[model samples]
Target: MSGTSAGAPEPEGALEPEGAPAPESAPGPRRRRVPRRERERQILDVAVQVFAKRGYHGASVDEIAESAGISKPMVYLYLDSKEGLFLACLRREADRLVGAFQGAATASGASPELRLHAGLLAFFAFVSEHRDSWVVLHRQASELSEAIAAAVAEARRAVMAEVADLVRAGIAEGGPATQLTDEDADFVTHALVGAADSLTDWMARHPDQSPEGVTLRLMNMVWVGMGRVLEGEAWKPVTG
Candidate 1:
C-alpha cells in the first residue's frame, strides 16, 4: 500500500550503489592503549599497595591485576611473576631514596656538614612524602623471599657506602682533629644508618615535626658525639 507491505523482506546482500559511501558498522568498545612505561608504572603502583596491605606471602597476582584494572596475564607479561613485581617495587623505591640522598648530598658546593644536613633533610622528606614506598622498601622487602631480601640489602648497602664516603670526606676536611680510622668510620656509618632508619618510624608518627627540624635534631645528636670522638675523646665505664 502506502509504504512497503508489512513484513516485506529486503533484497539479500544489498550493495551500495557505485559512487556512494557504504554504511559504517556500529563502533565496538574502544580499547585504551597505555604506553608500556606508563602501564608498567600503573602496575607497580597497584602492586605496592597490595604488597603493603597484604605482605609478600599474602599479596596475589590476581588482586594486583584487578586493582590495577588489568588482567592477570598482563601483570605476568609485564613483571613475569609476583616476586619479580615485588622486586621491581623494591628497586624503584630504593633507587628513589638513594637518589634523593645523593642529589641532596651533592647538590651544593656547601661543606660536608651542610651536605649531610641536606641529605638528612631529603631523606626525611622522602619518608614523609612516600610512606607506602618506605613500608614496601623497609618492611615488606626484608620479610619476603631470599632473592628479594638480598636485592633490598644490596640497595641498603649501597646507600650506607655512600654515607660512609661522605663521613670519610668530612673527616678528611675536618683537618687532623676530625680524622677517623677507616674502622671507626665504618662503625660510625653503620650506626648512622641504623639511627636514621629507626628515626624514620618516629618521623612518620610525628608528622608535625618538620624534616628540617628532625634533621637538625639528628645532626645535633650525631655531630656532637661525633665531634668529641673526632677530637679523640673516648668514654669508658667506671670500674667498681
Candidate 2:
C-alpha cells in the first residue's frame, strides 16, 4: 500500500479545464516521504507485482518504473536493475515469512503438533496475503542468473536453518520426529521445504481454494505423515 504517490493525480489542471489557467493545487498530494527502509519496501512491492505478472524474463525495468510511477533512472537508482529489483523483492518476502514462522513456532506454547500447525498456517497465510511477493520469490527468483541464484540460496538457507532448528526441537521433545539423526533432520527439513514450495505452487494454480482450506489440508497431511512415521512405518525409498 505504501509507494510512490499511488500515481500522480490527473496533472492538476489537466482535468479542471482545457484552456483555463487552472488554480494551483493545494501544495500537491502529500508527498509520502519514503525513507530508506520504506523506499526499499515500496520498490519491492512494485517489483513483486511486475515480476509476478510478467515473470523475470518478460519484465522490464521500464515497465516496473511505469508501474511504480517513478522514473526509469530512479528504479535503477534504488534497485540497480531488473535482477536487483527481483532479488530485493525475494529477500524481503523470504525474510518476513521465515521470521513469521520462527516467531510463531517459539511463541505458540502449544504441543509440537499445535506449534507445527501454527507455523505452517502462518506460512500459508503469508503466501496468501502476499501472493505477488510469494510468486516473485518462489518462482521467478529460482530462474534468475547465477548472482541472483546465490541470493536466493542465501534466503533459502536461512529458512531451512529455521526448519532444521524446529526439527531438532521436535526431536528433543521425543515425538515421532525424535528418531531423526542429523542427516535425517536435514532430509526432513528439506522435505518440509519442498512440501511447502509445492503447496504454494499448487495454491497459486488453484486460487479458488481459500487460504484456510489450503493451510488446514497441509496441516492434516503433515500431522498424519509425522504420526505415521513415528509409529515405525516407513515408505519405500527410491533406488537409482
Candidate 3:
C-alpha cells in the first residue's frame, strides 16, 4: 500500500451520489466551471458504477470518463488513474458503511441492545440499497493488484474494529451480556460480523425481509441465547 496511488496508499471519499451536489454541465457555448471537489465526486460516482458492473480489470478510464460526461485527462487529474479511482471507491463505500453503523449505534439515550440493533439494521439497509457499491466492496476487491487488495483488506479491518467496539460497549452495559468477558466479546464480534457477511446472500434471496425485520431475527438468535444461557440454560451433551 505504501507505494500505491502515486506514493500514497489511499484516500477517503465522497457521498454515494444519492443527494450529492449535481455536477455543473452545459450544452451551450458557455460552460460553467465545476468545482474541483464536485467534479471529483462526479467522476468517483460514475467510476463506482463502472467498476461494479465491469469489475476491476474490465473497467477502463476511457469508459468511466465518458460515462461521467467528462474527458479522460480530467479523470487522471482528479483521481490519478484507474487504480486510484478504485481505491477511492473502496474507501468511500467503507466509510459509508462504518458511518451508518456508528451513527445509528451511538444515538443518545439508546440502550446497548437498541444500539447494536440499530447498527445491524443500518448494515443490512446499506447492502440492500447500495448493491453496486456492495459488489465492489464485497466481490471486486480480491481480483486486482496487491495494493488494491491491501486497501480492501483495510476496509474490512475498519468494519471489524467498529464491531469490536460495539461488542465492548455491550459488555460494559449490565445485562445478560454482562456474563460475557472481553474475550467472549471478541468471539462474539467474530460471530456477528461473519454471520452478517454471509447473510448478505441470504438477504439477496429473501428480498421480502426488511432490514429491521432481519435485525430483529438476528437479535433473537444471538442476544436471546446470551440471555438464556446466563440463566443457567446452557446446552449440554446427550449421554449415549
Residue 119 local lDDT, model 3: 86
Which candidate do you rate higher for lDDT, 1 or 2?
1
How far residue 32's Cα lies from its native spot in candidate 1, in Å, is 3.9
Whose lDDT is higher: candidate 1's or candidate 3's? 1
Off by over 4 Å in 2: 1-34, 175-179, 231-240
Write down the TM-score of every candidate: 0.83, 0.75, 0.83
lDDT tens digits, residues 16-55, model 2? 1223222223567655434444445566677788888988
| lDDT score at residue 94, model 1, on the 0-100 scale | 85
In angstroms, give how far residue 172 of model 1 lies from its true place: 0.9
The model with the greatest lDDT is 1
- Candidate 1: misplaced stretches above 4 Å? 1-28, 177-179
- What is the lDDT ranking, best to worst? 1, 3, 2
Compared to the true structure, candidate 3 yields what TM-score?
Answer: 0.83
Instruction: Write candidate 1's Cα lDDT for 29-73 as tens digits.
Output: 655455556666787888888888888888899888878877777
lDDT of candidate model 3 versus the reference: 0.76
